[model samples]
Target: MSAHSWDVRRLPSAEGRSFLVTGGNAGIGYFVAEQLAGTGATVILGSRAPAKASAAARSIGGRVPGARVRHVPLDLADPASIVAGVAALRLESLDAVVCNAGVLLDHPPRRETDNGHELMFATNHLGHFALVSWLAPLLAAAPAARVVTVGSLTAKSVTLDLEDLQSLRDYRPKRAYARSKLAQMLFGFELDRRLRAAGASTSSVVTHPGGALDSLTPSRPVRSRTAGELLRGLPAGLLVQGKEAAAWPAVRAVLDPSVRGGQLWGPRVLGLRGRPVPEPVRGDLADTALAAALWAASADLTGLAPAAAGPAGA
Candidate 1:
């Protein structure tokens, strides 16, 4: 469908398909899973907390009757957990995997993962890097698979420092978070280039959830917003939107047959609040050299080989 004609309320059918959404138990990820579940597709919620994941799954089931939803234990900051999570999935093939889980620390004392990498960089970029690498074979096994990388608008304002990816030298919370997201966007674009060159059937697409506010979101079993909170969020709602709306870009990227690899999708109005639509990749996001460098660094840090080339539609 054309971008102008695409409708968020009416999604394309995804019957008999399966998708894995990292951090699918809460926030925008939870809504993404809920929306996808409405299409009759099996939605696997990759989360670290079993209780939260179960609650999110029940919420989805209640909202969409007969919706197929399950959870796999996943902690993006831990490589061992990622491996175990992927292993635990029973599916022989996956239609898509949304790299949506991320961390943004507001205040300061820098934190590191057990692996010794910065928390934001490790979880936001490297964790997904490793997960995708491990899931590569399953993605290749599908008729046509998608890897949707969720980026951030914060990335547009900051430049990635390849030498200081972990932010050991200058550890401002926001900047570090932004740079990590920038690195992820670079990885998505670079992965698509490599997939095309290798004739792989899998495609990498990047998307951003413009500006989502929890206060503006509709209530669910997993998260409930009080009337007072909604009232306070009214003014901001004119500019931004709720987390349910934030899931649009990622959902469209996953289900829209016309969406091609290396393309970007996001909120249509001012790239902030409205229907999801195709958006132009700009500035550092379009830099091939930087993407390649980031890809090499990611591979080295994660100790995963570059995505293997396979036959188209393999």
Candidate 2:
């Protein structure tokens, strides 16, 4: 189908394919998983909470009959947990992985992971960096596998300080969150560059949800928003969108054949609310030098060398 003709409600079929979506237990992640399940593909929900993941899986099954869905424990903040999660998947190949899990701290003193990285940066960027590095082999095994990184509009306003990625010098909650997302976006672009350089079949793609509000989301078995809540959210809905709509860009990135690596997918209207489309890569996200620096820093911090795509089954 043409890019202009792409339809969110009627997605292309992906039968026999398999995908993994991190943070698939709630919010926009849940909707991404649900939509993918509707496409007749096996969907694995990667999350820190087993019960929540299982519940999300059940919810998908309930909504889409014969949906192939399951859960794997994955805590992005913990490298060991990521290692365990990939092992638990036990897959010879994977078609795509949506790096959708992230933390946005609204308030408080700054927090750090067990490895001493800032909480937002650790979970939002570094954890996925490490996870993708480990999954390189599995991704290589598939035909044209994709790593879809879900970024945020917040990154457009913030800047990254390579010297202090963890914000050890000055920690403000929103700035830290935005910077972490910026790093994630940069990582996506850099990963595509490296993949192309290595002649790897696996491609990296980046996308942003635009403005997403839970209050505007459709009711689901897992979490239902009251009518009153939706009514109150109507005003914001004009500027923003529900979590279901927010999942569109990432979902399109995963399934759209026309989408290419190094492209940025986002909302079409004012970049805030509308159907997903390819958007211009601007600002820091377009800075290759900055991305290269972030990639190097990520490798050093995560203690993971970039994984080259080896021969299938190698």
Candidate 3:
């Protein structure tokens, strides 16, 4: 609302708080973790690669002196990885978990994860679903713990198809990715509702970074990068904020005390790219039918229960 209010400096000291974030080694996830680390939070940076995850913590520590950053190996594609990551959470109590890792379907040739789930669904949605399920207990144990999951503006572009969740019957990269993201939104909404109904203090909040694309960034949609230059170039128009800016919404979603449970926040402009603004997302993410279906499917995939949420759904 104000020019200087959203600055990271305003974030309270998270000295006693403990947090976990997947994909915190790079991209928008990194920035959110960095912000928390700056506030003295003991942050666990979950990565698919152990070595890379450690390197990211070192990198963050370099930028922010005395930053408490730890690395934990987590690959969303594998349900076992989530199990392992959860077991490795050394903290006696976890204050919050930020599910920041996500993928865009720019490459083709259709892929699938180890669990026989479509690659996009496995990594983007199922992986997160599995992770949250594992970490449910830690969240519930804390009176005001929270989980912040990242969704895409593209979530509105697709609808859930419970019959073909894994895309086993039909597969399209973009559609599958969109479908997974929608699942994330739905999971967050329904998770919040369930937490409340069960009388748990843990809350679920979701947000999107709009579209952050730049010619300088090697990793992004070609259409987006090309369009970035052809349209209006970086940060001006026709493009979303860079990952640095995108990280703001994510950081706020996790650390801001005023943020309410079940609310989705993002940029205020068209396509949600500008400054981080609090707003609910578009679509039926709160749909009970699809949420229940997703919950069951996730349990089946992970062999975990809705009641047995783990430490970190790596």
Candidate order by decreasing lDDT:
1, 2, 3
On lDDT, the stronger of 2 and 3 is 2
Model 1: per-residue Cα lDDT over 103-189, one tens digit each: 999988999999999999999999988889889888998999999999999999999888899999969999999999999988999
Q: How far is candidate 3 from the true structure (C-alpha RMSD, Å)?
A: 4.4
**CA lDDT scores, all candidates in order:** 0.93, 0.92, 0.77
Off by over 4 Å in 1: 309-314
Q: Put down candidate 3 lDDT per residue, 1-314, tens digits, no spaces.
A: 24237665567777878999988877778777877899888999988877767767877787789998998889988888888998898766788888888767776778877657788888887788878887877777776998888888778878888888877766788888888988878888777887878878888898888876544233422112465463555445455566666777778877777887888888768744676777744446657787888877777776665445553232
> How many pairs in model 2 have backbone atoms within 3 A of each other, for residues 3 or more apart or on separate chains, i.e. clashes?
0
Q: Cα RMSD to native, each candidate?
A: 2.6, 2.2, 4.4
lDDT of 2 at 260: 97
